[model samples]
Target chain A: MIERPHHVPERLGLLSGAAADPFLTEDLLRGVQGHGGVDLAKVVEPLPEDDARWAVEPLRDLVDDAMFQFKENRTDADGWLAPRLHATLRLTRREAADKRIWNHIALAVAPDYVAWRHLPTASEGKVPRINPVRFMGAPDRQCFSRLWWAAEMFRNGADYTPVVRACSNQDLIHNSLRVSLVDHRPTAQALVRILERGTATTGREINGLITAINTAGATVIYDAFAEDEPRDPWALRQWITDAESAPPVPRHVLPTGPDEEPVREDSVAKLTEYFADLFETAPVRGRTP
Target chain B: MKFYPYKRLNRPIALRVMSATLKLPDGTFDPLDTSAYSVPQRTVALGVAQHEDWISARIGLSATLPPGATDADAPWSGLRVLAVLTDGDTNLRTTVELRQDAPDSKEWSGQIEVLRDDHAGRASLAAYAVATVDGVEGRSITETDADWTVDVVSEEPLGGLRLDVKQAGFSKSAREWLRPYADVPWVIDTSGRLPLVMINTDVEGFSDLLGGNGGGIENKIHELLLSQMATDVWTAVFHSAVGDLEVEPDGSPVFPTDWRGEVLREMLPDVAPGLHVEEALRRVHRRRTDDTGWVELQTRIHYAAVRRAGASKAVANALRALQQMNREDSE
Candidate 1:
């Protein structure tokens, strides 16, 4: 048996300078080997090997592609990577809610990715460090979990296009996901539509619109107007069941969601109109003049 | 040397009445029932009775005399003499003076002396006097100058329900309600169930439309409210039960009679109802079934369409041309 020596690259700053000396690439590979052959299957719990969704290689490849694609613009990676990651993962909402699985992925399966994606930048003469919460926190706060949940909540049925738009606007995904109301499909869709239409181009505009909508909701009943189709529970069950035999989600094109009915166009139109009306009255700081 | 709660000098006059009776030769001269004598100017009146040279009279006194004054003036002295008048009328007038030595002390005493009286009676007479008191003058007292202090406890409870505006999702509503008294201290408990929905509209211009101040806090609250409203609407549409739909094994409702197809068929009357079923089935064919080997063949066809779309020739070229034309016209 041969023991591999830990190797440190020449550039210390390439990886976060805050990491300890032993926390290098060779050490990470050793950790992966120690945890059973760098297969994410060994790391995640409850999911059996036979489950087609259990394959981690495809996801690792996708992550690599994302890291390569957004090499220059790390912030822009969230919008592009989130929906694709969700589509490729192909898990039921029930499975996605499991924090243990995300914890394992961030800690054991892909700690390097977490480090790469979320290592904080230095400011105010102080060295920046990653918060531990990003690896194992609530769904709305954890690094990968937040992105995955954002993708799930924002995507239209059988359409990941709207999700891309929503995620692209950092404020919309980051702020709206924390709010319980974004759980509504039509509202999520309508919000994305507002962005797509260029009704809200700037971050300030997005913030103002969000504020006005929240305030107006005190008196208005948004549900009374924007009706959505009842989700067929069997469809979701079937979608989850199909995971064992389902093909890999396409890398180049957006993956299809479950065949459940999309939000009604009329309802989305109504909300968009209502929200537009609200934004008109909302007080924007610079626009006060 | 006796001290009362109220000084005798400050106390109003106390009036006392005394009477004596005179006896007449006839047994009918009982002064107890003497209604004959009347005095117009007398402040007090007395009645007398006489029986076999033994006589007595009853006297009544007025309450208008000076404090501590005694009945020793002209009217009272005249009443001591028994002068029978032919006119059969007797009356007396008198004045009483009250004196006090201590002007500043809480403990002070006074005496009253009655004066001036003219009375003429047959055998015995009774006399009475009235008393009066003057007002006391002093400076106003401050709280510090007072000897004793009184503290009153409020018999009422504290003000309104304390609410945690953040948790209750009523921060905005609570703020709005409390806006008029912005400077006043208020206790808000935000633990109560909020009736309002918290929406998060992360879109531009929406918050302004809703009349929110587009500050970060206000915008965040607005987005929360909108999100809640959207969820409510979505839940109502999707989760509500209908009589016609059959519940699937997994608890999803299914249209037992192809009801959805029927509606679509009816809307597009030109398309035969049977053809609508075929179209729906064709759309369904795009989905994969575990038992059906037909999925592979169907996927192949889909792949071919996708490949053609990707390739720079054939159907893809035609579609691209059409899309380009549409874009040009819109521009």
Candidate 2:
């Protein structure tokens, strides 16, 4: 019998030496081990691993695509990753609200990615640290959760185009997501229209417009003017039910969300015009008459 | 009480006692409703007088003559008349002083003056009295023909008026209270050791914490990186920080010292190669214009508190550190 040495090798062989080092690889493996395994079956509940409803492999594929597609420009990763992440991880709002599932994924499955993505700068003058909340927290603060929500909120009906636009402007997303008014589909789409129109170019402009809109909301009734379609509860239920047979989200093209009606065009148009006027009158920093 | 008697020789003297009744144009007893008098029976009694002949005698017992009631006094015009009456118990007291002047005309339209005293000797008189002759009502001076119309328009002595009260929320009070602090730019003090220590301490743990999936580290890192980049780009494009920068006296560098740009410059070399300062500046400019796409992806996580065993000192230190870093970068 060959005797195993007491001391193990300093590094573990995984990917190419250039691509994978022991520390990162070990950390990644440990992260997966910490939660059990990377199998979607292990992380998700009420959805078995082998069940058709379980799309863990497909989700893993999506993450891999994101890693490859955005290899050069990581900042550009969000636009590509958000909608895809949402598509791959098909979940109901109730399921998503549970922080445990997200915690399992972050801590147990893909901690290495979290570390890789979140490493602190040297100027920070401390060991790189992560907030435990990211592992399991509210959707707004969760690592993967915020992106999914952003995509979900900004997407216009089945179209993900507006999501892309809205995600592009970090200020808009950061500010808009915090505002309850953006839940109104027309308001979200109208904001995106403003961004697309180049009416709000700067962060301050976006912030100012958001502030003005929020302030104006105190007086004017936005819903009275910009009406939206009533949501069909059955559509979401149908979509979630269809998750068992749903195919992987297309990589090259933007995936379609539930077949809900898009925001009213007339409503969006009216808001676009109204918001434009507001932006004109808004007090943007350093903007002189 | 003096009673003047013109005797009809060997016959009973017939002296008719005249009394006057006055009514406001609205046909109401104005003084009875408004007067501070303890007894209001006098104005009602005068208001119900029957005829002109009864004016001089019945009114003489209770009511004071109006400004124009006697020719020796000035004519009363555009003044409300209130009938004054003596106490019922003192009906026999006839010699009384009229505090105000009597009206010059018999058809007098003026206020009647009355005097009164409590049993405690606290004597006071009505400021003015109203009197009108029965069967001789005067024409109303006002176009609106209001009842008991008094032309005595007096300005209130007090200058200010009380307005309606309003209620506000906690945030409103906070904003109002903090407005002064925000008015002038808040100059971050960088020389403080607390902020530096706190920032360094947090930054040390930041990397490890930021790593892993679904742990918000990635999002946080992304936000920090973008914020750092944005600070640099804004500085490059605008030649200043978006917010105010605090500087030391005599043009010396404060703690913040535009550290954001320095940090970005250090990281840019590692991220992209062969980039000159001019190119780097240009890149920042281009990113500023094109980077609107990343805004939505940025998530804000508020750090409620980072205290040590229920002590806020640690968190306070952390804030100081953040402020110091910001100040140094801006400088």
Candidate 3:
């Protein structure tokens, strides 16, 4: 694997798509050498010099540790990395929505991590190429972004245990995140619950279940049946405010997210039952009636 | 636009907001102006700064069902009314159940809590009546004909696609990029998060003419000039949006998620009439890349832009003002 950048920025900087495009060369994507940090840093539009939260060393250390720790099993890295990444990189949804920030993270700071994690397994008989979208793409397709959003969407209020569970299932992250229906907290929890209970084990099963839920979502308002507690914006704001002095997320223990109330148990149960029923009738190609 | 197996109310449900209040960060509440709601536009602006310390906004909604809704022999059972607040940007859907006014009352009322964190810009609110029909539970029997736009961030209650307009002295503005475009009265920039119409104040009296809400021929001419600008902006944004779209793994285009998506959704139907927005986008994208039918589609695209800018209406008003002025001079 490629080494960490020689000189990491003190703070995170925005890398516009145009600035980042040239660096996403074919050589870097094929697990080859990427441009060093010195060249990339010259083009980076620096974030506000004053904000402590934009500090890059903490984030660099996190990704470096993530890569080293998960060297044995890369696919497992996502479950470990997602919540920690979110906790470490404190941002409002508006700030997170900016593609440029994520683009910078993937290209300038951690292109090696991108290639290491997403380079396809040697099965297709094609050149093992990493998709450039992983470096600079939509939230769902971009490597770092998908993890951040998965953490955001699946995290039950301040609890990220559900996020870990959701990220564990690759199919859940791959298929479910693209669908807006999973944004509903109860609905997100219910999918995690189904996966935990072994209702849908295979990728195909999970994909079918997600499709069924999304289709049913078009007809029925799932929120009407399984209502979530109205989250306090103050709590989220306070949590973000606390990021400046917050401790680094633990390596072993799962970190707690914002101090907000978790999704109601009854709502999760309601949707779990409803979704399991939907999955049973859903057309899984390999499964027989 | 939606089909259900159950027997539904033929008449549309009438939904209106009865009150709106904002919850502050320090645990106090304040009344939000009722003018923040536009009945004609069917939109309610939750008049609180999203970045401010406000916690949430509670919008009290009243919905009146059609006459047959409360009939004793109605086909459905376990009837319930709900207000669904959906934010496409955040992908959060919140539903609040409404209570009937009396035993067989057609009037239903409830308040939906708008969490500031859950919405980015505009969220949509719609009312639906659901019930068990033919053994299917929680099936939507009827819904509001049009969803009301609940803009969590915007202070104005205007509906439809609204682009940002800013007054900048191009010659001496803080924005360095605008300095190059100083000669022009305005420029349309779609590269940003939203399409911004930068009206250059360097053009003498240009700002007054565009900003003027005065009476007489001046107002008519102002309206005409604004329409012309809008036409140019709409055209530019549409092209910029179509030019830059993400494609799925299967090579099909993925509908954008930002202002590009909104612009496409609003103008695609007009650009490619009778086709769904997604399909229209695909067609337009295919033509642009494949070197076929793109040049021909330019007229339709321009027409859509012109229509959105209300060029015809502006021209008619200008002509009417001229006619009135001619009559006054003769008199």
* Global lDDT scores for all candidate models: 0.44, 0.43, 0.82
Predicted complexes: DockQ each: 0.01, 0.01, 0.34
Q: Compared to the true structure, candidate 3 yields what TM-score?
A: 0.83
Predicted candidate 3 versus true structure: per-residue lDDT over B1-331, tens digit per residue: 6575558788888999888888887788988777878889888887555436566888999999988988899898888999988765566677789999889989999998987767667777899988877876777777798888887767878876768899989889755556667899988866555577889999999888887788999999999998999999989989988887766435678777566777899999998999987788889999988968999999999999999999999999999999999999999
Better candidate number, 2 or 3, judged by TM-score: 3
Indicate the residue-level lDDT of A21 in model 3: 64
- Kindly provide the TM-score obtained by chain B of candidate 1 when compared with the true chain B: 0.14
| Comparing 2 and 3 on DockQ, the stronger one | 3
Off by over 4 Å in 2: A1-51, A121-124, A130-133, B1-331
Ranked by lDDT, the better of candidates 1 and 3 is 3
Q: What is the C-alpha lDDT profile of model 1 across B1-331, one tens digit per residue?
A: 3232222233333232222233333434333322322233122223212232322222332233233233333121111101111101111111122122233222222222111011122112121211121221111010011011000111111111111122112233322332333332222211111112232223344435356666544444444444433333222211111222333223443332212222222222222223444343333332322356444444433332233223333334445556776788899
True contacts kept of each: 0.00, 0.00, 0.31
Scored by TM against the true chain B, the candidates give: 0.14, 0.15, 0.79
Please give the range of 10 consecutive residues that has the lowest summed lDDT in model 3 chain B. Answer: B46-55
How far is each candidate from the true structure, as Cα RMSD in Å?
A: 46.5, 33.9, 4.9
- Mind giving the per-residue lDDT tens digits that candidate 2 earns over B1-331? 2121211112111111123223333334332222212132112122222221111111222223322333333233333322222121111011122233343432322223222110111111121222222311221111111111111111111111111112223132221322223322111221111111111112344434334344333444444433443333322322222122222222222222123333334434433346764354444444434657223312210010111022244334555667776788899
lDDT (Cα, tens digit) per residue for candidate 1, span A1-289? 1112122111111111111112323334333322222332221234554666666666666767777888798777887788877876766554564455565555544666666677644468864655555655546667777788788778777778888888888778765664434666777888898898888767778877776776554323344346566444456556767877777667677777767778889989988887776777887657773
Best by lDDT: 3
Name model 1 segments beyond 4 Å from true: A1-46, B1-331
